[model samples]
Each structure stands twice: as C-alpha cells, then as structure tokens.
Target: MSDGYSLTVELTRGGDSNNRDKMRATVEADTVDELREKVDALRDEMQEWADDFRNIQPEYRRELPDDQSQLGEVQA
Candidate 1:
C-alpha cells in the first residue's frame, strides 16, 4: 500500500450485534521531512495553551502567609 494510515474502531452493544468503522488517510510525502513539519505545528499549539495557564491565570499570585501575624501575637 501507499504511504497512509488506517484507523479502525468497533463498538458493541449489550446482548446485540456489533458496529464497526474504518477510516483511511493517505499522505503524498515520499520522505520523513513532511511528517516532521506536521509534528512541529502541533507542538506550537500545545505550547501556547501552556503559556496561558502559567502566565494569564489569576491564581498564579503570591499570597501573604496565613499565620497569626495577621491577628498579632497574644501577650503572655
């Protein structure tokens, strides 16, 4: 077969027949260089999502300690 991918999924119901599906994809690239390009694009998308979580999230702040300093120490 040509350079391609095939995915098959099957689901079965309770006490009944089974359902099957098959998907086939073909890439016209003759070498691995084209495949690497596709992988790089996916990586960039994932990095952008991670940056939003780390930098844009409001919970990523430094809070004061929750010790008794806020209420002042009790005199002996």
Candidate 2:
C-alpha cells in the first residue's frame, strides 16, 4: 500500500488575472513523522485564520441579533 500526501488549490477572485492564485505543496517523504510535521504546520496556519475571526470588526462581520428579541427579525 502507498500513502499519498499533497495539496493543491486554485483561487480566483473578481475575474482578475492578478487575483488568480495557486498553492502547490507536498509531502513526498516515505516517513510518517515528516508528514505529521507538514500537517501540523498546516493546522497552525488554519488555526491562525480561525483565530482571526474574533478580531474582525463588527461591521465587517455577519450580522447577528443583539438580543433574543432581534433574532426574530431574520426568521423565515
């Protein structure tokens, strides 16, 4: 059996050529430890973004009810 580990993602925004981006990285090592190190780094990066959501300003964030009463305004 073979263990495969690699990731590639393409991103495009606003139909702008300048906004096109691609990330190509891989873990080709046959050892599990090396793969864990790579995966841990990815986890850390993703966590940083997760941590950022709290720092975003209220206006830039999705709106939520100010109280139990306001929650009904968005109900279907």
**Which candidate leads the pack in TM-score?**
2
Residue-wise C-alpha lDDT for candidate 2, range 1-76, written one tens digit per residue: 2776554422222355543333334444456777687767876765565456435543555567566556556657
Candidate 1 accuracy as TM-score = 0.32
Tens-place lDDT per residue, model 1, 1-76, is 3764323222222342332222223333445676556545545654565455345433455555666554356455
In model 2, residue pairs whose N, Cα or C atoms come closer than 3 Å (at least 3 residues apart or on different chains), thus clashing, are none
Q: How far is candidate 2 from the true structure (C-alpha RMSD, Å)?
A: 13.6
lDDT of prediction 2: 0.53
Per-candidate clash tally: 0, 0
Task: Tell me how far the alpha carbon of residue 67 in candidate 1 is from the true structure, in angstroms, after superposition.
Answer: 17
For each candidate, what TM-score against the reference? 0.32, 0.35
* Model 2 misplaced regions, further than 4 Å: 1-3, 6-30, 57-76
Task: State how far residue 18 of model 1 sits from its true place (Å).
Answer: 40
